[model samples]
Target chain A: MSQIIKQEKKRSFVTAPTAALLSLLLPGLGQILARRVQRGLLMFGALVSIVGLLVWRITLLGRLAEGFWPTLFKSLDRAPMFVAFGLLAIAGLWLWIVIDAAKQTNPNRQFGNSIFVLILVVFFTIGWQISEIDLVKLSSDANEAWVPLSKILWPWEAAVTHDTDTVEAGAKVLVDSEGQAPPVPEKTEGEPYLRVSPRKGELSKLDEDNQVIPGTKITVYGENFEPNTRTQIWWSDSIGNEFRPRYQGEYVSVMTDSEGSFEKELIMPYRLIPPSAKGQQIHKVMARQVSQVGPPLPSQPLILTIELIIETIFMGMMATIFGIIFSVPISFLAARNLMSTSWLTLTIYYLTRTVLNIVRAIEPLIWALIAVVWVGLGPFAGIVALTIHSIAALGKLYSEAIEGINPGPIEAIQATGANKLQTIMYAVVPQMIPPFVSFTIYRWDINVRMSTVIGMVGGGGIGFLLVQYIRLLEYKSAGIAVWFIALTVAILDYVSAEIRQKFV
Target chain B: MLEIKNLTKIYPDGTLALDDVSFTVEDGEFLVVIGLSGSGKSTLLRCINRLIDPTKGQIIMDGQDITAAEPSELRRIRRKIGMIFQHFNLVDRSSVMTNVLSGKLGYINPWASLLHKYPPGAKKEAMAALEKVGITDQATKRADELSGGQRQRVGIARALMQNPSMMLADEPVASLDPVLAHTILGYLEQLNSESHISVICSLHYLDLVQRYATKVIGLRDGQVVYRGDREDIRKMTDGQFKEIYGEEAVRVNAGEFDQGEK
Candidate 1:
């Protein structure tokens, strides 16, 4: 019996290597050696299917190429179906290979499957190279050819209406430069020197076809303007009317030449202009200019709308600061190891989680609106909204990190005469630092994205500018704002990824 | 240095783990507690250090009643006594040096320890302890990377780092092979002789206790069935051994004895 047992062990040792070598030559060969013929055949079938699908896709593309653009464009619309089928076939083949590898009894069979997988990987790479598409050129051509007919309408011209030759009350207007108004004194209490122009009657009324179209031009003439003085120009439609302000041609500060002349072309509210009143009525025009340096010269109160770019940047920074500050303490309460009692832990956990869910559930814009009502419209309202949401989200993540720490050191510290606080400081805090830094970076990324959204509701950021542009139907300007936001998010993601990699 | 008076421990599950156990170990005595699995040997050792609170007993160590001490006072008392586990319980991810430095935590202020700002004297003492254990060269290596015997040596160094008056080792060698087990026991014996520190170790192998233990205590079903010197334990009759262990175990030991002759 002893001799027979020894002989069997020796046989296994020798056959194991031999079986492995055979399996290494072809996929499923080891399974065949192990007497699993059905499994081997299944693996073989899967390999054949993958190769067949690749060949079919390549051949179909080749046939389409024979006729070039005509056939290719026709077939391009159906390309998604072919891609989906190819993906399914690939998935099926992979699953079969994995199952066969696992069910294989002999080590030799596993070795064979490994080599087979390696070969297939090389083949798949070659297939991918053959299937590559020139997507870059295609996208560029599409962009160049497709111009919507809406561009021809020139909607900005129809944005305003005015009375005939009479500057009526509440009529949309522009500043008229031809007036020889007196120079308004600096810090003047009453109205300052200003030029007012009516919206032209010719463009104010619709044609016989009944399409509303409007056009107007007004210029500002001023004296004693410094050669480099910066000026802003804006216009507002009738109050309480639904004519939303157009954001086109808004300049931060148009510098006056040495002659004190600043000319700007303004487009009417093309995107958000309200429908013209039933009858033509007079509208007011207002214009004022201020120096970039010192206090504004007592200029007429310009009715032109002002967009505050600096305030937007300030609001975003303040919100981020407060968010980080409030999140720190709440996170400690939520950590499980620091809070030993399960009841206390559960209470804080649920409370923080619920608050975070509620904060995240409402868009930051909604929060900003509510905050504006509470705190008045300013950066303060935006800061409050971001702070509350950050605490909830950051607290949950920080607490989870604390709970996942190795309990050994905590126990060791507790085993000493140290109190609970001391134990946490010595054991829990050290372990939590790497993850905390990582979470902070991620939160910064999230905060930047959120800051843009909150700006739309007067919270003050780039989003507020974006909203103004979109409301005016200036898609090009709106596109610029969107591109900036996307680029910022991508850059932040890359930076945070680099930082996280260091910790890992 | 340590004394127990009629200690008893009945777990919440209604299982009586230790019952009316009593013993005393004088200063510098190398005492070994021996029993089979589930024999209350571990319970008896843990009770001495108050690692597990006894249900109905008093533990008098250095003339103070440790069992009735307040929580803070109990912690203070525990600081003076070092305990080693079978698993070593070293922080696996930390360096061997850090694991040894943790033993000095009981003496240093917690904030100081948290910042890893041990006094120069403490650092010297830690180095000395590591040197005594012959693992000074592996001070910076992670504890998990060491072999079982080397890890156990580091555990001993950590315990010594406490500078405790009494040491308790529970199944310290149960995970080691026979030769390494003997080497560790020899180290423990040497520490006891040189430092005059009272040593109480629980051991599973009967032959091991017979070889190195100056005093042997036998436990059975939570009761101290035998308490005497090693010579007296070896002279116990087959019937007495059968009474503590079952007949099958006594017969097994007898077979081992016969096998040794070969």
Candidate 2:
């Protein structure tokens, strides 16, 4: 030891200039020569990590192009300021390291390790640039999010709708009659009525190319409707499927005057009649107006959201039940304490551990995608994916619980002439109950949260509806789904916490 | 009679915990083993019931070879030889009754026991064991809810449930107070004399050993260094004490044992 110490002392006599030159070649090299090995290694690691992060950011910003130099140049071209900032920081660090290494052996050196603070500042700045953290953009572009965000924040408006009372009036028209056109319907007093000129004509039909062929022109007149009320035109085919007919890219709707009368011209809308029909087909055009609004009722989005949220809850529940059933046995196989007694058991332990780790390393969403492919899209797919992930996760947790149990009782029970299975039952199982209950509840909580997200990959739940609403820019509807998910998760967390307290 | 001939236990790590140990305990003998912490007392006790398989040994109990017993045979032999521990190892989460009942596992139907269906008489027997240990009132309580003395009493009751011919107590009173040590030993003595059950107990204090042991063996570094009967222990010399306890040990209150309160 003394001889090695003497040799180290002799090697530490390098001049300050030489030390500086050595550090200039590579950061921290001179510090190692100066006998500050730990400091030197730390400096080297910090420099490499910072440079690597900077390079990674550049590559990411460079459109992830192939090759380093091209990507770096492209990144520099795209973000000159960030590259310059990074380069300047590196230069500063390089100079500081050189200076520090030169003065490292000098007992009179005054500067504390201030380079660490500088390095931290540089790291933060690089992280800021890499993340594109822009407070200015956040403030300036608030308006774009405001439209959706405001609706999301207060979405009760979409939750309910008022019922309406409709006044209907219709007139029948003939379609390709053999002899003559049908006469106009006679009008009655004190009732809404509609009349058509030359009541019968050939109904519009699609040609071979599926283009509409305009039918004969006709004048339609309406009277005795609610005054100043908007009236919409509806057409029903021979099979009685009613739809609002479009005329020149607009619905055929008009406002009634104070006298409750109006006139409009229309072309008979195209209708498809089955070729198997044996008789002449008649089509009906109706003029409808909503005159009164009634009591409020749940909106369609609200109903659909509730239905899907229930499905999502059940998906989480079914997965958790399946997870518990499979993981309990797997956990025993995976537990090191229980399985370490023999070579065969030890192999089983390692195999179970590896399989669990591989399965758990993959996120449930990825599994959901695979499941969607296997089972097609539905809640069953979500349940399958969540169950797979939960089993792996719960298996690991339960095995850890088993490994952590007190071995004292196990020894005591074994000494009592209990069989191996009996020992586990009386000694190990008793100790494992609290941790098992706690972990199961925790896994159930995670499963519920994951079930909400798996639906985005077409696993049927509220998330499926949520993504669609988001895609369609239906923010209010999406907001309802989001609230339901958040509410369910919060409630589940509380319920699980309460249950854990009672059992664990 | 229990006879151990050429018993040796070398652990997997090559620790010679017991080396060529041999001893004999006649029926109804209250044999107390005296040794330092690592002097093979616990190992010897564990070896007798085959809790730990001896590296090499012959343990003959009433003409039966315990050391060479198969797994099923070993369990059957273990049940007849009850063992209590220093730490009072009761299943803390289980009711005291349940912990006591588990001691009867070797003799019960294995499948019925798996489903926790003890025979109708088993509970009554467990209650009787608890009554003997003076803890019948605590039968329904969780084992951990009891005091140290109470827990040890529960341990004794659990061992009693086996209806064993011989008992192994490994530093049974080491964790108890000085007074409670006598109380626990008194219970063992009563069982030894009144019920005619033999006891192989390890004790630390010389005063306690001299009071309770019908026969005594002292060990050091896994080798027996001293042997004495009740009369030899009462008149023990410092030279013999040093041979077993080493030169560094001091005999506190040498005059206390001469009085012999009983």
Q: Which number leads on DockQ? A: 2
**TM-score of each model, paired residue for residue:** 0.53, 0.81
- Collision pairs in model 2: none
True contacts kept of 2: 0.74
* First chain TM-score for all predictions: 0.40, 0.75
Q: Give Cα distance to truth, residue A192, candidate 1, Å.
A: 33
* lDDT by residue for model 1 (B121-239), tens: 88778778889878899999988899998888888888888887887888888887666776677778777888888889987666666666779887888988777786876776667
Query: Which regions of candidate 2 fall more than 4 Å away from where they truly are?
Result: A1-12, A21-84, A105-111, A160-164, A170-185, A194-287, A291-299, A342-348, B70-73, B237-242, B248-262
- State each model's C-alpha RMSD to the native: 14.8, 6.2
Cα lDDT of model 1 by residue, A384-479, tens digit: 777666666777787788778887566555554555666666666767777888887787777777876777787666677668766876654555
